[model samples]
Target: MDTRFLESFLTVAESGSMAEAARRLGITPAAVAQRIRALEDEVGTLLLSRAGRTVRPTEAGSAILARGRNILRDVRDLQALAGRGSIAGEIRLGAISTALTGLLPTILARLLAAAPMLDLYVVPGTSVELYRQVTEGDIDAAIVVKPQFAFPKTLDWHVLRSEPLIVLAPERIADRDPHSLLRSEPFIRYDRNHWGGRLADSYLRRVGIRPHERLELDALEAIAVMVSKGLGVSLLPDWAPPWPAGLSVAKIALPANAPERHIGLVWSRASSRIRLIQALQTVASQVSMDPIAG
Candidate 1:
């Protein structure tokens, strides 16, 4: 059976009239009818029945239509795969702002050097938004702090880095005991919905330490800034001195307990970019291990 005839027959069945299908296919109505007859002859069965100006599928037409749809879908997929042999298109990668600042550039540079034709588009958003985009297939993949949320069973996750959490206090207070620091100051907590926030909260609760009942904020940089101002103590991954230049890092160790933050790559198992993903993963692991991320 000719695939062209199957396409014409399918189009007629969908549009319900030869005139409409021909108009859509930019063919004459008589040509559409001829193709339909040829398809019927090949199958040795009637495909469509006329009802005034409209057409309805016969039993054979319904069967052929179902098979034709599958055939067309496979044809389109084959075409797509054929054209996707090169990594020469835009790649939209999303990450948390912190990750964007810390790790994204490194990965993008590696990706560009390896796949020169790829135009990288970087989207910086909260972990929650990035997770949704990854789940919905809006983003090709993501490099964000791991979220404490339900992931679809179809996704692949890789733990790229596990960063040690630290206490952010004034330069003068850096040497003080962490328990005393946490107890004496209003701990400016990050928003609890983020994975990092929830992880910090869980760790604090487990350490038998309670943050002062007052201040809370969301953004990492903002919390860092507040900690620098001596508004309160904050706990975050040990990356750098917080804002307000004079700030410094002090590592905190609890009895048999230490808080950790995870950064990782998340991608769909059904995604078409597996080779590119593997390449990115190879480079990303290196980026994750860089001393700058510390």
Candidate 2:
């Protein structure tokens, strides 16, 4: 397929008019029309159907549009690979909330220091959303964690080893009788939909350690605050940011059946940025040294 023709077709799809597409491409409307005609002739299909002053895609046009975006993405990747420019481009990364505290600093601090001219964009969300962004090529890379994490053949996921979940409580809080205290007070619940939350929930279920669900909270700091106030008991990753003042560690035995979750960095081959991917891998390797933290 002609690269020029694909470019023109995409421009038309974006502009929804041959004249507009030609204007954006800095070419005559006739030239743009010729490129589309050339593309349609090669494909042996009617790609677009006219609708008054506007244009709409035929069934074939919609299918070709999808492929065209992918083709453009590949072209961009190739150009980057061939370029000799410094690592000065924008790198967009999405991370789970708490993961950013340690993991991102380990990775991005180096990147920013190495490439002072680079523009860094960091978006924090749940792990599941980060996975979607990577798959869509919307972000360059992401850090994902969960027990059932598996890579599709088309995508890639690198494990950073398992991070054990630990219970954080007050200094004198009931460590062995967490359930007893929970029944007496409110039990702070982490967001069950998140990776940490779900993993903690799984452990609770496996051990049959049920607490009265008083509060459903997500943020680690917030949970620590509630726990410090003697509101409840909570389970969290042993490897976490600093706890609030007065908060203490509450050790919970790993259930015989429940196991620690493996933390990983996942990226889509379709969207992986070489520098961003490398930075993430380097950080993961460094963090793997800590046995308690994920």
Candidate 3:
């Protein structure tokens, strides 16, 4: 059976929309449907159920899902193994938004320079999503905020940076107490759903400061812009820089004892792309040592 067909089926199943799967695969919807039909034919089972625009996996499809992923992973591993001594082939690397903009570019530049044959496919997501993807082997590795919980033995993690929480406010309010500003000003809250955001939430609770919340979001750079426009004050990690330029915002430092947000690399220890991942880790380590380098 054609693995491409299986790939198409899995993509469609995950996305829940044929058009979306087609778009992601860079193919027409009709072509995706054709592949799905062919796969179903080969398997002698109906693999999917469709209702309106949404597509869901049938019982058979659901049963085969994990095995299908493993099959594809093994196939890719064979391809990478074919290269043997060379650090080549694609690495599906995920990163949170801040790391995507601030840290990944530097690491990618150095990594590609050292291994010109290496291909990188980057997936951007929240730390929570990226962590899940890494755990499930949907991606080889991720740059993300460190999870509060201990990692299972199947994975490995390395700290890249430790960003401390800071108050983001307009220059006009820069002089006010960091905790006081959070209580008085319209607060542009960091989304509590994220690991880093949870740190901010914990700090707020510990300090007994309930912000006068005006908005809640996950994007730090966008939050900086909002604060620059005097939309409200926010509490966020002092994430690696190249922050949005020309923003008249101030990053007010919290007390020295405040909690920190640790960003790191997380990857499957069993990935066939371990060599490439090691290369990535080396470059990431170098970049982390001198964050301003690119």
Give the alpha carbon lDDT tens digit for every residue of 207-254 in model 1: 788878557777878777667666878877764222334445345654
Model 3 Cα shift for residue 67 (angstroms): 2.5
Q: After superposition, how far is residue 12 of candidate 3 from its true place, in Å?
A: 2.5
Q: Which ten residues in a row have the lowest lDDT in candidate 2?
A: 249-258
lDDT of 3: 0.90
lDDT of 3 by residue, 227-266 (tens): 9999999999988878999999888999879889998899
Off by over 4 Å in 1: 1-84, 240-255
Candidate 2 is scored at a TM of 0.64
Give candidate 2 misplaced runs (Cα > 4 Å).
1-79, 82-88, 115-118, 147-149, 178-185, 245-258, 287-294
- How would you encode candidate 2's per-residue C-alpha lDDT over 184-255 as one tens digit per residue? 555688788777789888777866767777788878788877777767777776544544556554656444
Every model's Cα RMSD, please? 13.2, 9.5, 2.8
Model 3 lowest lDDT segment of ten: 285-294
Winning candidate number (TM-score): 3
Error of 1 at 154 (Å): 0.6
lDDT preference between candidates 1 and 2, better one: 1
Pairs that clash in candidate 2 = none
Order the candidates by TM-score, highest first — what do you get?
3, 1, 2
Best by lDDT: 3
